[model samples]
Target: MKSFRLDELEAERAANDGAYLQFLRERNMSVGLYALDAGESDRQQPHGQDEVYFVVSGRASITVGTETTEVARGGVVYVPAGVPHKFHHISEDLRVLVVFSPPES
Candidate 1:
């Protein structure tokens, strides 16, 4: 069994100066923390695997396919494989827990 602490992961990510820090990876899925500061842009492109995003904290708007909506703490979102998605208009620092099925090839 394995456990993780969000604060620890966040600190690691910040120390690495990276926007995302992958914490767990297995045969079925992968988990990571994604951070975006206010006025920053999410430059991610479409992925080959489905994904789920849990907003750990902050406020922003995400666009999946042609749909767009606001998200904040406790907000959850799902994106299907091959769909274009990105977060924008961040009003606060965004910390999102990202889950990708099939290990995010």
Candidate 2:
């Protein structure tokens, strides 16, 4: 078993409006910590595996396949494999845990 502190991961530098850290990954799954500074919206990506997002702090707007949900602290979202999703219009200082199964390439 492996464990880590979320704050230690490399902060992903951005020219855009958010920051993230790809903190931990294993053979079957990967985990990340994400933060949105400002103007964070309209992010659409096709995922290769099932995903679970747990809000560590702050708020988020998560979208999956035409459905949208507003998630706040302690909120969680489950996205199935091959589903297209996005994080939209989030202006709050957000810290979220993103887990992906069968680790993407």
Candidate 3:
């Protein structure tokens, strides 16, 4: 079993590129913490693996392909493999938990 405290992870901001912090790695999945400050943009492209995003805090509009929606804390979003996605119009400092299935190479 593995455990992590969000506060501790947030405190490690210096080690991160203000984008993501990969916290766990397993045989078939990987978990990462992603954060974007207010007004910052998510410049990620399509992924090779399916992914799930759990919003930890803040608000933003996420675009997946041609669909876009606003998400806040406690909200969840899913993106299938090979789909284009990104977050924008961040109204607050956003913190999210990202999970990738089948592990990412």
Against the true structure, whose lDDT is highest?
1
After superposition, the stretches of candidate 2 with alpha carbons farther than 4 Å from their true spots are: 10-18, 42-44
| Root mean square deviation (Cα) for candidate 1 | 0.5
In what order do the candidates fall by TM-score, top score first?
Answer: 1, 3, 2
- Which model scores highest in TM-score? 1
Q: Quote each prediction's TM-score.
A: 0.98, 0.79, 0.94
lDDT of 2 by residue, 1-105 (tens): 777765554344243334656667789998877676446664547888898888877776888888999988899999998888887767676777889898756
Pairs that collide in candidate 1 are none
On lDDT, the stronger of 1 and 2 is: 1
Measured over all alpha carbons after superposition, the RMSD of each candidate to the real structure, in angstroms, is: 0.5, 3.0, 1.1
| 10 residues in a row with least lDDT, candidate 1 | 96-105
TM-score of 2: 0.79
Please give the lDDT score at residue 92 for candidate 1: 98
Regions of model 1 farther than 4 Å from truth: none
Judged by TM-score relative to the true structure, which candidate is superior, 1 or 2? Answer: 1
Q: List ranges where model 3 is wrong by over 4 Å.
A: none
lDDT of 3 by residue, 14-93 (tens): 46656888888899999988999999978888999999999999999999999999999999999999999999999999
Clashing residue pairs in candidate 3 (N, C-alpha, C atoms within 3 angstroms): none
